[model samples]
Target: MLDLWDGQLRDIGYESMGENGISGRRYFQKGRDNRTYHVHVFQVGSPHIERHLAFRDYLRTHPIEAREYGDFKQKLAQEFPYDIGSYIQGKESLVKDIEQRALEWYRDNSKLRRTTQEE
Candidate 1:
C-alpha cells in the first residue's frame, strides 16, 4: 500500500522501481520534511499479500490473540530496542503459530463462502 505522511503528497519526492532484473514488486522510498518513508506495493492476488492479510484477518477476529501478540512484540522491541534483526527473530515462533491458525481460518471461511454461493 502507498503510505504518505504529513504535508501534501506533492513534496514526498516519490521514487519507484520495478523488475529490470531487480524486483518482483514496486517499491519506493523518499525523504520529506526530514522524514523518510518507504512503501512496497505488492501485486494484486499475490501470495505475499494473501499471507499478510490472512494474519490481519485472523487477529481481527481474535482480540485476545491479537493483544497477546502485540504485547509480545512490545516486549521484544524493548529487549532489542536498536536491533531490528533480533526483534524479528524473537517473534518467529509466534508468527509461525499465528500463520498456521490463519491458514486454517482462511480455509474454513473459504469453504463457508462457497457453500453460501451455491445456496
Candidate 2:
C-alpha cells in the first residue's frame, strides 16, 4: 500500500515508487479520480525541498501571505473544481507567471540560508 507523508509517498516497492526508490525527490501521482497531483518530499538539506519548506515557513510566519495564498487557491478551486484534467494542460504561461511570482516572493521574504554556505 502507498503511504502518504507531507507531500511524498513511502514504503512502497520500487515499481510503485520509482526507479530511484524515493531518495527524497519530487514526483507526481494520480488519485482515484484520475486527477494529477504533484508530490514533494526532500531530505533536510536538499536544495529543492529546503526551498519549498522555507517558502512554507515564510508563509507561516507571514499570516497575510498565507491568507493570500489560501484565498487564491480557494478561488481557483471554486472556478475549476471539476477541471482537473485541463487545469494545467494549456496554462503553461499562467504557470510560469505564478512560478515567477512565487520565486520573487520567496527571494524577498524567506530567511533560508544560502545553499552554498559552509556548515
Candidate 3:
C-alpha cells in the first residue's frame, strides 16, 4: 500500500505499530509543507471502514450538516493557523457527535432499504 502512494506519501500511523483498534495506516500528502490530502487505508473486515463510509454517505445526504462541518473547520483553521493539534482537538467533539449520528442514520437507512427490497 505504501508503495502505491510512493514519493509523496507521508505515513503517519502504521498497523505494524499495533496502536489498537482500526487505526490502520494513515497517509498524508503535502506540497511545500502544506497538507493536500489525508488517506486512510485499512484491511478488509475492519469496522472502521464501515464507520468512515457511513459518515461520508451521511454527509452526502445531509448538505446542511456538511456545510456546517466545513465552516467549522474553516473557522478552526483560522483560529489555529499554526497549530494542527489545537485545530484537531477543537473539532473532536463535533466530529464524534456527527459520527454517532451518521452511523445511526446509515444503519437505519440500510435496514429500510433491505426491508423495502424484501417486501
Winning model by TM-score: 3
Each prediction's TM-score against the native?
A: 0.69, 0.45, 0.75
Residue-level lDDT of model 2, residues 30-111, one tens digit each, is: 4533334545545457666645555566666768767866676556666777885454444445445555556676776533
Which runs in model 1 stand beyond 4 Å of their true positions? 1-40
Span of ten consecutive residues with least summed lDDT in model 1: 1-10
Clashing pairs in 1: none
- lDDT-wise, the better of 2 and 3 is 3
Candidate 3 backbone collisions, by pair:
none
Off by over 4 Å in 3: 1-22, 30-34
Rank by TM-score (best first): 3, 1, 2
Least accurate 10 contiguous residues by lDDT in model 2: 11-20
lDDT tens digits, residue span 16-86, model 3: 22322335644444443355444566666777888988989999999999999989999998999899889
Give the deviation of candidate 2 from the true structure as CA RMSD: 7.4
Model 2 residue 55 lDDT score = 59
lDDT of 1 by residue, 73-102 (tens): 889978987786798889999999999999
Each prediction's RMSD to truth: 6.0, 7.4, 4.8
> Which ranking of candidates, highest lDDT first?
3, 1, 2
